[model samples]
Target: MRRTLGRMLADSRTQPAHAPGASNDPLILREARADDMPAVLDIYNAEVRTSTSTYQYAERTLDEQLALLSSKQTAGDPFVLAELADGSVGGYATYGPFRPREGWRFTVEHSVYLREDCRGKGIARPLMRHIMGHAKARGFHSMVGVVDASNAASIRMHQAMGFQVAGVMREGGYKFDRWLDCAFLQALL
Candidate 1:
């Protein structure tokens, strides 16, 4: 069974005031609202334009991002946003079906992103923990992260979170006029 956003938000409030990647500032990890789409889109589009985090070369519009968020909500998938003390939408994490086949129902692929300035501030760790908790609560048996092999920070972060490197696919993606290798990491819930 899927959990409601309200329930998830309420549950987050009951957790420790400061988890990893959190500091003196009040950090909130909760379901995203419609008004949050612009900030979310900005972060995503920045990645699309400048990073190999996503293979999408074209930037996504606000409507498209909003639609995707809506789809996640409709499917009861976890899509969480991280709010900094100043109320800025600094990052987000989400999970979706790893594959469409029925046998893959117990597995999900997850992703996390943070604003450029928000990195190294102890935000992603707690945000990712919230995502993992949600996935586990929703009965997922495994969570996978497909990260770029060259992205040391992300790789190390996943490793710190107990995700084991499952395998690597050389030249698995194309971006920036080159082929990029992808490393897959998995954590059993």
Candidate 2:
């Protein structure tokens, strides 16, 4: 079945956080609210500290995160959260205009961050699929992901979702006392 924002939003509204004694926990994708900022920020900041996934050197402040959340919400951009069946925030995905130029209106660049413990749990693929469906519904023509060159798992996942590597910028980013290459992966809506 196709995933749509409307369907996910409805599911978010109706699904209970968890069923008592349930052995398997389902993944839930929903629009992020202001209250979700703390959890989202924690996931992002952890990546900032330990990974090359983001080129940022300093950890993001909560106020800054709050402002970003507010802006995305106001602009109707997709800023979504992925929660466990127990209602704990495990990850988040968001996208914004690829560039400020008018011609770039139909393109977006996205980011996904998952908590350390959430890796390999099959969360990212669904979150990305949701973002693509949501963006396509909003009239976007393409979505891009700028992933670290060394992140083969992420590249493979995007490839599975129909994204292709468009280009690579060698040593385009610096973090952790070394240069990092960034690969641009694009998918048509």
Candidate 3:
């Protein structure tokens, strides 16, 4: 599965056998597109506004989302989308360089965001699986996730997928009027 980024991008969408929660619409895993920015931003901006899922204090605008997408694309990172049959985005996943230094080239930091209504519905498993596969295919030696300590659900999900707690940065972030601890999880690819 050592596919080039172009080939991965050209791959067709998949209608997963997953039947998340009570919903009958089986999600499709596909490469994100420019037109999908609005839906993707809705899911991300919501987290920025309401949860510790993202540490950003302000919601992103459409232009900002597009710019982020462009940066990811330029860096050869994969941004995946989980979509229902009706075309609504349920979640998104992506990974980028762990750091700007060349020594960190073999490691990547990933992010996965699912809509609030879509959580605990088994949607995350497939999204993470795809992203992991994509990273491995690209020859990344390791994948990492820096999650908020309060986000037990996300940490658990990563652990279930072979990620181990690397360490914890005590009070690494401040948001919502308090300091939030950050848990670092790593998985060998």
Specify the highest-lDDT model's number: 1
Identify the superior model by lDDT, candidate 1 or candidate 2.
1
Candidates, ranked, lDDT: 1, 3, 2
Record all residue pairs in model 2 with backbone atoms less than 3 Å apart, i.e. clashing: none
**Which portions of model 3 show Cα errors greater than 4 Å?**
1-25
Tens-place lDDT per residue, model 2, 59-79, is 989899999998998888889
Flag regions of model 2 displaced more than 4 Å. 1-25
| Per-candidate RMSD, Å | 10.1, 10.6, 10.7
Structural RMSD, model 2: 10.6
Every model's TM-score: 0.86, 0.85, 0.85
lDDT of 2 at 24: 33
lDDT (Cα, tens digit) per residue for candidate 1, span 9-108 = 2333344422243335468889998899999999999999999998889999999998999999999987898998789999999999999999999999
- Of 1 and 3, which scores higher on TM-score? 1
How far residue 5's Cα lies from its native spot in candidate 2, in Å, is 33
Candidate numbers sorted by TM-score from highest down: 1, 2, 3
Report lDDT (Cα) of residue 186, candidate 1.
80
lDDT per residue for candidate 3 within 1-189, as digits (tens), equals 113222322321121222122233378989888999999999998999889888999899999999989999998888999897778888999999899899999999999999889999877878888878878889988889898876767866776676776777878999999988887878777
